[model samples]
Target: MSGTPDGQGLAPRTTPPSITQRHTALGIEGPGAPLADYRAAFQAARLAMAVVNRDGLVLDANPALGALLGTDPARLADRSAADLAGLREDPAQWAAYLAVLRGERPRMRCTRPLPPVAGAPRWAEISVERTADGRGVLLCLTDVTERADLQARLRHLEMHDPVTRLPNRSLFFERLAGALEQAGRARGGARIGLCYLDLDGFKAVNDTLGHRVGDRLLGAVAGRLTECAAPGGHLVARLGGDEFALLVEDSRGTDQLCELAERVLAALQRPFDLGGQRMSLSASIGLVERPAAETHATWLMQAADTTLYWAKADGRARWTLFDPERNAHRMTRQALSSTLRPALERGEFVLDYQPLVGLVDGVVHGVEALVRWQHPQFGRLSPNRFISLAEENGAIVPLGRWVLEAACRQGRRWQLAHPANPLVVSVNVAVRQVWDSDLVADVAAILARTGLPPRLLQLELTESAVMGSAGRPLEALQQLSDMGVAIAIDDFGTGYSNLAYLSRLPVSTLKLDGSFVRGFRAGEQPNPADQTIVEALVELAHRLGLTVTAECVESAEQADRLARIGCDTGQGWFYSRPVSADRVSALVGGYAPAPAVGSG
Candidate 1:
């Protein structure tokens, strides 16, 4: 009897026991006594068993062992037990078996694959233990082939998608993580690439043709994608809905990824015929490939998602590559949008005034109140960086109210300082301010708080926002105008250019867009078309009782050209760039006596 490593055994022996004594000590008894009972028990045992000497040579094997090996019991004698049990194929297990035979280890157990016998390969768990005499070892083998096959089937079902019969998102992510980790350990600049794809207008197909057809279309698309990716042996996965991803491990470079994307796009465009309901569809792909050492799974997927949006935005049936600079800009925009509401409360906003000088008199009559963000982390940012973002996120309502209140306060201060010639303060208003907020009440409240007359406060809106105003917006504009607040259309000629419709609305002034003003050349070869257009616009505005202002007047030459064309006021760098409040005050103080309101 062999003892386990835990210092326990069936029987203790001070000296080596004979075969009969060993059998009798194990409680085997019958009519034939020890040897006959031992032989009967060994042959009748269900588990395959063999006895080997210290040299690993099999001294004897039971009929059960012969049946497992597909051979005769006598033939197993004189054969190497390690070889018969397939332990010699694995060096570690062979070494462990040798250690057990040398009495260094009490026992050792391991699983190994057996060579084909009778055209049937088998896997078995083999156990080797030292005998009670410490002169030989007993080997036992157990078949586990069925268990291995069952586990493999379960793994396949777990990792694959049922619809497209491809890998699902779970397996895709697993493979991506593994590829990234392996690439990190690989040498020679190995990289990973991903093409994140989404079928364009796939929802419409489901809406009209039903989901069954949509599913079939998806299956066809998956087949095409697999065929396209087959050349590079990439992994194609269906990531829910119409979205799919192709993963390239050990990618060559951007060129390879781009080529694969182009191939996939071409393949998907060839009209998917789903049970005679033929339809043509396209896909947008976002491609990202980088050195695996520099990125991980989450960041890579995010980049791919963003790039896919770019592809759709740039028009579908195309692929866009990941751009770091663009990604940084988008990240900055998101950060600004998320922090905008809190930033207003933090007092990070301030106003800078640009002198809206009168083109005819060359006097500073008004100043446009431009808002600036004094961010703690990003420093100062101008309106172009965040105005639209604020509007989209609904932060503009509060931010706009703050700007109006602050500008009015400053306007009242200037009125007190220069009652003889008070400068009108102009502020830009986004369309959302009217629809999303109580513009009428907000303006009235700010006017009362700051004691700034509506006559000295002018509100500027883009032409597109004010042109087609109706419903609440139109009524709001009419009320603001009736309250004695001047309403001017900023960027006048850019949008809807409905000059004739201006007469039907309560508009007071037109601030020509910078593009039209930039067209006013000064040299010998001036742009005649631009000069004629500006002259006609100014004349028409004056006739309609609306003041005309020229924007982006950079040089004295351009200012002279605008003034000669009957433009009433000019706002540009020729007079001054947007400056601090203190700077605007100094300029106003140095000005000569002028009218209270020179022009719009």
Candidate 2:
């Protein structure tokens, strides 16, 4: 050992002192022979090791350390240990190394890149820990180049699609997340866009041809998409199967996205010659572009997906840009449809009745029961809002059942209150209800439970549903009619106006559609065509023993014309807008005859 000017020991030893000797020198006790074995093992070990003072200068280095750095063991002394492991190049790691050297930290570990050596690793994991003696720190340098390279290769394989050699969904989403974060912090109106594409009739190709051919086609499509995206340097990714997406970061606007979508569509239109098998194909693209700060990954992807479906639905082979209004409507419909069944069970549905007054007597002849949905989230929803959605999702059957029962119960209450003038309750029925449910049985059950006479209950169906009656529908209607329930054709002449066919069926009345009544103008320039049509329909209905009910009678003039045409009963705003059950009862209680029509 040699003494330095600062009174610290600086030594170059043939064999480094054992830990026991070092501890003993520091006034600690340990067995000597085992520590001697530890000292020898440190010198002969494969791991590179060094002992450095508090200043980060190497006091001593093992043979393994010298071999790793490609220098002699003696030359490593007095050298900066951080410089040896290349940690000095990184400020964070350099600070950490200094902290450990100054005894401020227990240990620090980091991986750093080293200058390439002919037969040595180019990366090292440097770990610095304070020695037990507290006089110095121990540094270990591990060669991690092999592990680093393995991890890099594995990451590459995981982030890329095996077939198209493009980034896979995992990597695409990762990049999208990063981009969104950056965009959120960016200034100005930085935006992002995505084009979600699916090959039309791809399944057909996979079915007719082998999957091998299908995969080849996908590869070809990916190549074309990559070429199209190359001009903008957009990232193209394969999102499984035949679906691909192009992510445009820092997008200019929707125009840029739309232009890219059009280019992709045009590119996919060309014929492909795959292994002597020729085929032509088209693609449908859904494009979404918005300010990156305003949207997230899931919402942006949903918009793109919905737009793509719209492209397909609007006859395919095209591109559709995201429309906020259309998307809102679709989302609302979805929300209503999903909640419809539960809403019925939750008793969120109620009925409002509109009085259908007699054109001759102006008496409150009957009331049309209209279903209203008192949705908690969306507030009150009229039938036009969710009825079609309910029909599509098969919720109409249960909902229709509810409407029938509720209407019947209310109609029975009115009948018991005023037996002398019991009003019929007419309920609108969806075509799906007729097919999907036992309509006749449901109506019978509802009437029987409510004690409402079948004569006081009428079921209104569209002409299309009633005209071509056959099989179950015809049988259901005939049975209900035989049970004394009146079957009236709602929206007459709007659908198949097979008037001759109505006589052969068990129909009792024809409620002409509001469109025909809308055509009946009140001025001197009255629509003669509309009047003639109504008159002829009324004459034919009266001759066939079917009552003619004109709908949408908004004014007394229109009502007078309808009554003069020999129309039986009328339903419209002229009588009243659809009102609550209490309001309908008030109208029924205060009935009066319509004023006589003068010959004009």
Give TM per candidate: 0.86, 0.85
lDDT values for all models: 0.86, 0.87
Local accuracy of candidate 1 as per-residue lDDT tens digits, 1-600: 354322223243466555455344433434555577568878899999987766676667888889888899877765778778877677898788878977899999998887666776678889998877677778999887787667767888888888899999999999999998887777558899999999999999999989988888989999999999998899999999999999999889999999999999899899877777778999999999999889999999999999999999999999999999999999999999999999999999999999988776778889999999999999999999999999999999999999999999999999998888899999999999999999999999999999999999999999999989889988998999999999999998889998666997888999999998777665644688987998999999999999988899887667777777888998888778899888888777455222232232
lDDT value for candidate 1? 0.86
What lDDT is obtained when candidate 2 is compared to the true structure?
0.87
TM-score of 1: 0.86
Q: Model 2: runs farther than 4 Å from truth?
A: 1-51, 58-80, 88-95, 116-122, 184-189, 524-532, 589-600
**How well does candidate 2 score on lDDT at residue 5?**
21
Worst 10 residues of 1 by lDDT: 591-600
Model 1 stretches astray by more than 4 angstroms? 1-40, 50-61, 72-112, 116-122, 125-139, 592-600
Task: Report each candidate's C-alpha RMSD, comma-separated, in the order given.
Answer: 5.8, 5.0
